[model samples]
Target: MTATAPVTPDMLTIPRKDTGGGLPNLVGMTRDAMRDALIAAGTPEKQAKMRVGQIWQWIYHWGVRDFEQMTNLAKDYRAMLAETFVVAVPEVVTRQVSEDGTRKYLVRIAGGHEVEIVYIPETDRGTLCVSSQVGCTLTCSFCHTGTQKLVRNLTAAEIIGQVMVARDDLGEWPEPGTRTEADRTRLLSNIVLMGMGEPLYNFESVRDAMKIAMDPHGIQLSRRRITLSTSGVVPEIARTAEEIGCQLAISFHATTDEVRDKLVPINKRWPLADLLDALRSYPKVSNSERITFEYVMLDGVNDSDEDAHRLVKLIDGIPAKINLIPFNEWPGAPYKRSSNNRIRKFADIVHNAGYSSPVRRPRGEDIMAACGQLKSETERGRKSKAQIAAETGT
Candidate 1:
C-alpha cells in the first residue's frame, strides 16, 4: 500500500516530505490524530477534545494559521501549540487568472517541487481541480501532465491544503462565530480530482484529505459535491464508495481496448472490461448519483460515430453520464482536438441512447489551465513535438 513500492527507480530521489521539519503538521491530521497529538503535547485528557475543537475551527473554519490568532484558547496553551506544531499549506508560487474567470495556481511544496491546482467558475458551481501527485505515472499520450515523469505522492495535508489555499485566495472563510450552516452560497462550491495526477495512485492521502474536506465543522463540503476522477483504478473503486462515498469519474477516452491501451497506457493492465465491471457494481452509482465517464475527444482518434455507439452500449445497465471533453492542446502535444461538428455528432449519438452526453466547453485553454494541460511549471519542453509524436504514434 506504500506509494513508494511501485515507484522504485522513480522514487530514488524523492523523500517523504517533512512534517514541518519534525514537528507534526495540524493541517491534514484526522480529528483523532489531532486529539492524540494534543494529549501527547501535555494537554489534560478531558481538555484535549475541547482543545482540538478550538484549534480545528481556528485552522479550518476561520482560516487562521498562526496559533496566536486562536484567541479562545489560553495564552499559555496557545504558546504550547505554537511551539509543538505548524499549520502549513503549499506556498503559491504564481497564479494565473484566465479571461473566463478560471484561476490556475502554481504552488511550491516541500523539496522545492511544484504542482498546479485550478479553480474554474461556472453558473451554478465553482469547481476546483486538485492534483494528487507532483507529476504523473499514467503517461496518457494525450495528456500534458503525463509527459512529465512521476515525482512523489503528496501528503494528506498537501491534498486538503489545496482547498485551503483556494479558499484563502477567494476569501471564502467566514469570520469567527459567524456560522456553520450549509445555507450560504459558496464561491468554490465543488471539487474535482481532475488536475495533474491520477488520484487513485495516491489513494490513502486522497481518502484522508477528502475526509477532512467533508468534515462538518471544518471545510464542510458534502460527499456529493466532491468528485474523485481516476483513470479506472479497479481495486480502489469500491473503497471510494464504502469509505469516502464521494462521486466517481473515469478517464474513459476510447471505446476499444486497442485504442485505450495506446491513449491511456494503464488500460493495458486493467482494460475496459474490468473497469466497466467495477463501475457497474460501484456502491455510489444510482439514478441520482451516476458515475461520470470522461471521454476526451481526439480528432479521428476517439471521436467518431461508431465510437459513440459502442460507448453507450459499453456502459449499459450502469447509471452513467458521459462527459465529452475536447482535447485540450498543449505545446508539443501529439493529438488535435475533434472538430466541433464531429464532437457534437458523437454527443448526439450517445444522447440518442439513454445517457446524457454533453460536450464540455473548453475552459482556461488560453492560460493552459484546461483539462489534460496541467504539467508542472518546471517540467516543460523536455521533448520535441516529433519526439512526442513518435511516442504517441500520431
Candidate 2:
C-alpha cells in the first residue's frame, strides 16, 4: 500500500517470500488449525492431534527448530513432516543493549520490513515488549513509532514469532520432554504488546499468537502475564477480553476530546466517551485485574492536576490503574516530559482517588528503546549525499 492510502488491517497484503514457499510454517497456528494442517499434509486423521502436540512441544517447549531434533517420532514420519512444514520466527537483524540491560532487537520480517521489540530486565520480572505491525497507522503525535506510516498487519506467525525470537535470545526454552515450574519466572517473565503498533487493529493475528503464548503445551504463559496495549480501538475492546483474556492497557494521553484529538488521533475515530464506555464493561477487568491507563506525561500538555482529577472521574467505576510514563524524547519530538514534581502531583491525585498510580521509570533511553520511542529502520527515507553531509558533516 502507498504511504498515504488509508490502511485497512484485514485487507493489507502480506509478502509471501518468507512463508517457506509451499511448505507451511507451524509457528503461529492454533492447536486445532495445526492439527488440520497436519492431517491435510497426509498424516492420518487419527494421529494429527498427537503429532501436533508432539511438534508443539518440540518447537515451543524445547525451542528446537530442526526436524532432526524430533527423535521421538518415527524417522520417515519426521522426514515427511519436515518436508511438509517448517518452523520460523522473525530474523534478528541487530541487537542493541543499553547500559541498564534493556535489549532492543531490530528484526527483519517478510518483504524485508523491520520492527523493534524490547526486553526490559527488572529485579522481579523481565518484560518483553512485542510489536504487532511492521509500522504503525495511528499517528499519536507524541509517539515516534506513530510518526511512521502504516505498512501491514503482522501475520500470526510474525506476532508469536516475536516471542519465540526473544526466547531464543535468552535461551529460556527447556530441554526436550522436560519442563520445570520455576522456568515460568525466568528472565522473560511478562509480555507487553506495547512495542510498535496498535495491537487492537490487528485483532485476529494478535489473538491467535497470544493463544499460542498461553497454550498449556507450549510457551505457557499465564493470561495475567500478557498485556495488550491499544490506542482505543473501541469495537475490539470487549473482543480482546472474550478471545485473548489478557490484561488490557489503553494509550490514553489526554483527558478531553479536544486535546486528545491533537495527541492520539485515533481518539477522533473513537472518542473518549465511546472508549470509556467500552472499558467500563470489559468482561475481564476486576480489582486484581485492573486495566492500565497508559498516560504519557507530556509537559504543559496533559499533565495538569485538573487532568489527573478528570482522569480519575472519567475512569470512576472501572477497575483501573494509571501508568504515568515520562515522555521518551526522540529526534524532532514536539513535546517535553513533565517535570518530576508535576508527575508526582498527578500520581497523588489518582492515588488519593483510590486507583494505583505508578510513575513508570523510563528505561533504555540511551538506545532510544523506551516507551513511545520504537521505530524500525525501514521507516526512514533514503538520504542524498548532501543530506548525509548536512546531518553528519562527513
Candidate 3:
C-alpha cells in the first residue's frame, strides 16, 4: 500500500516570532532526497556513495563554510553540485562578547528570521551550543527562548553551520601540518543541543546533522561527546536514544507536576511520571553513561529541600546525574534565580540521597549566554507597533 504524505507545509515560512526570518531553502527533503539529487547528477551508484562521503566530510569535518572551498572535488563536479544543491549558512548578523569570554552569535535565517548560538570557551574545552529551530514550541516559563512561538525546524545544513561559524571565530580549523585524529577531536571538544528550540521536535533534521557530526570520516566527534537536550518530548525520547545514540539531557526543572506544569508547559502533555518512565526505558543507557537531568532553581518555586528529596525518589533506580542550574534571569523573565544558599541546600539534599548533583556555574549571564538565556540580539531593535503603543499607553 502507498503511504500517506508527510505532514509538512509546501512553502517554507519563517515563524512569526519577535525575531528571525523565513527559511525557504531549508524546508523539505530527507536523506533519500539528498542522495537522489547526487545520483541524478551523473554520479554512478558507487561514485555517488563516494561523493556523498566527500561532501559530508567537507560540510562537517573541516567546517568549510563555502562550497568553493571544497577543492578536493573537480571543478566541473563542484559546479554541477552547486547548481543543484545549496550549502546554505545562516547569516551572522551580530556578535556579542561577554565579560566572561562567552560569545553569542545572532544568526539571521532566510526571510529575516534569526536565532542565537552561543560559544563558551573554557580552559580545556570550547563548547558550541547550537539551536535547532527558529523559535520554540514549548513555553517553558523560565526559559527566554520559550517566550517565542514555534517557527519551524532548522534544516540539517543550518544546524551544522553553527559549528562551522564557531570554528571560524575560534580559529580552531584543522591545519595541514596538524592533520592527526587527536588534533581534530580537540578542536570542537563538545556540542550541546541546548541553545534554542526543542531538538526532539525537529528529530529528523537534528538526527541527520548529528549523524554527519558523529561520522568518523566527517566531523569525527564521538556520540558520547555530543549531548541532545530535550524538554521531555517523551514519545520521541526512546527513538532518539535508539536512532541517534548520543548523550541525553532532560530539561527537568521541577520535581513534581504542580511546579513542573507551570515551568515547563509541555509537562502538561507529558507529565513528570510519564517522562521518568520513558527515561527508565531509554535504550543503551547505563551507569557510566547516565542520563542528565537539568534542574534550574527558581526562588520560591522548585528549589525547596523537599523538592530535592522528591526528585531523588523520582529517579531512584535510574542511572542519572542532576545538573543544578541556577536560573539565569533575562529581561521580563517572570522568575528570580534562587539564592546561593537555596541552590546549595537543594544540591546538598540531592547529593546526600546518593545521586551526583553538581551545581552548574552560571557562565554568560552578563551577555545572555547562559543556559535558557539565548534569544536573537536583533529582536532588541524590532519592537512591534502594538508593543510600543502598549508601552506608551497611546
Candidate 3, backbone clash total: 7
Off by over 4 Å in 2: 1-22, 182-184, 381-394
RMSD of 3: 8.9
* Candidate 2 positional error at 159, Å: 1.0
- Give one digit per residue, the lDDT tens place, for model 2 in 229-269: 99999999999999999999999989999999999998999
How many steric clashes between backbone atoms does each model show?
0, 0, 7
Model 3 lDDT-worst window of ten: 1-10
In order, the Cα lDDT scores of the candidates are 0.87, 0.86, 0.77
Model 3 lDDT per residue over 286-394, tens place = 9999999999989999988889888999998899999999988877777899999999899888898888989988886777789988765455347686864542245
lDDT of 1 by residue, 1-394 (tens): 1111121111112223334676789999999999999999999999989989989988888899889989999999989988999999888877777767777888878877889998887767788999999889999999989987898999999999999989987888888777556776688889999988889989999999999999888888999999999998899999999988999999999999999999999999999999999999998799999999999999988888999989988999999999999899887678899999999899899998978988898888877899999988665445577865664466
Error of 1 at 274 (Å): 0.7
Candidate 1 whole-model C-alpha lDDT, 0 to 1: 0.87
Model 1 poorest ten-residue lDDT run: 1-10
TM-score of every model versus the real structure: 0.92, 0.91, 0.86
